[model samples]
Every structure is written in C-alpha cells, then in structure tokens.
Target: MFGLTFEKLLLIGVIAAFLIGPDKLPHYAQQLGKLVRNMRDYANGAKDRVRDEMGPEFDDVDWQKLDPRQYDPRRIIRDALTDEPEAAPAAPSPNPNSAYLQHRAKQQALATGELPPFDNEAT
Candidate 1:
C-alpha cells in the first residue's frame, strides 16, 4: 500500500519465503496478518471515536472540500496573479518625507532630464 505494487509485493514475499525458509514462514506470515488487521481495527476505532465525539455533524462534513490533494500550488498562484486587485483607496496628499514621494520625485526629475536629488549620507 505504501507505493508497493502487486509485483513488488510478490517479489518481497518470494524473498521473505527464501530468507525465512519453509519451516517458519507460516508463523511470520500469520503474525504479519494479525498486525495488519489490528492496525486497520485501530484506525476504524479512532474514526468511530471521532464520529461519536462529533455527533451527527461528523457525517455532514464535506470531506472532499478539506482534502489536501485538491489544492494545486501552481493553480493557486496563477489564480492569484490573474485576479484583478481591489481598487485602492483615494490617494491622500503626498507627504514629502515619504519614500514613495521621494522615489516619484526622483523619477519625475529623471524624466525631465534633470539630475535627481541624492543624499550623500546614504552613500
């Protein structure tokens, strides 16, 4: 079940048969079967306990909606990138001390063929 196909399981069983030998393979196989059964029972018991604790609401849960497999990182990113952003609030009066205004001023100076203001302290 953990990525082991039927063919792989067969190969493993064959190897186990050779390694364990015909004398004691049956005992080990029986133990493995018991282990698998117990694990399955444990999982089912846990599920039942959760259902009991959750009451009737557990049956109404939309499990498919919560499934991790349904999420695609690429699709999520694409949707986010393609979606139009919400309109920004109306601009307030520009503050001279703001970095955005400073950058804008620099851009305007460059566009008008003037040297942008520079701070010697920043260098």
Candidate 2:
C-alpha cells in the first residue's frame, strides 16, 4: 500500500487545483483518465499473451483448461476427429440389397404414376 495517507492525497489535490486553476484542472484530469485506461488495456493484452504462450499448464490455468484461447485451431480439429473411436457407419456399397430396398418403394410409386397422397389445405 505505498503508505499514502488520505490527508497527503487531499493536500496534493488542493495544491494541484490551486496551481493549475479550475479550467485547466478539468483538462489535466481528462488526460490522466486516458492514461489510466490505456495502462489497463495494455495489462489485459499482456496477460492474454502470457496465457497462450504457457499452454494448459501454469498456475493461472483455470479458464485456459475450461475454455482455452485456441492457439492452433487445426490441432483442436485434428484431435477431435481422431481421438475417439467412431461407430462404423453402415456403408451402402458393400450391401447392394439394402440400397435396393431403400429405393424400391419410391420406384414402384413413380412407375404407377401415383403421385402419392395429397393434402387440400397444404396449398
């Protein structure tokens, strides 16, 4: 805590206001406000940079693990695709009858020119 007392701070403020007048005091205060905001922004950017470079390990790795700032999107994608064993999808080429059965019902209707059932209110 810099050991800065309230009395000392008040005295400094009083002196600054007296020396710099009322009109210029407002302008000086505005500039000081801008400097404080810029410092805060720089600090946040630096923190993010350090987090990304350190990876998932580090003491401040709370958010980094739950929702990481992606350094490499391709790496994440690659891991997601290959990490888990996938259920082999039933392919159509090897079993020819399955494919035929899928289309047979549709083919029969088309040949008869039956146009399927219609709904009056649909239009």
How far is each candidate from the true structure, as Cα RMSD in Å? Answer: 12.1, 17.1
lDDT of 2 by residue, 7-119 (tens): 98899999999999998999999999999999999999898888788876656556665765655454444345554534444453465354335445445444565587689
Q: Please list the residue runs of candidate 2 whose C-alpha ends up more than 4 Å from where it truly belongs after superposition.
A: 60-123
In candidate 2, the residue pairs with backbone N, CA or C atoms under 3 Å apart (3 or more residues apart, or in different chains) clash, namely none
Model 2 TM-score, all chains together:
0.45
- lDDT measured at residue 26 in model 1 versus the true structure, 0 to 100: 91
Q: Please, what are the lDDT tens digits per residue for candidate 1 over residues 27-113?
A: 998999999999999999999999999999999999999999988654454345444433332563355334344344645334666
Worst 10 residues of 1 by lDDT: 80-89
TM per candidate comes to 0.57, 0.45
- Candidate 2 residue-wise lDDT at 3: 82
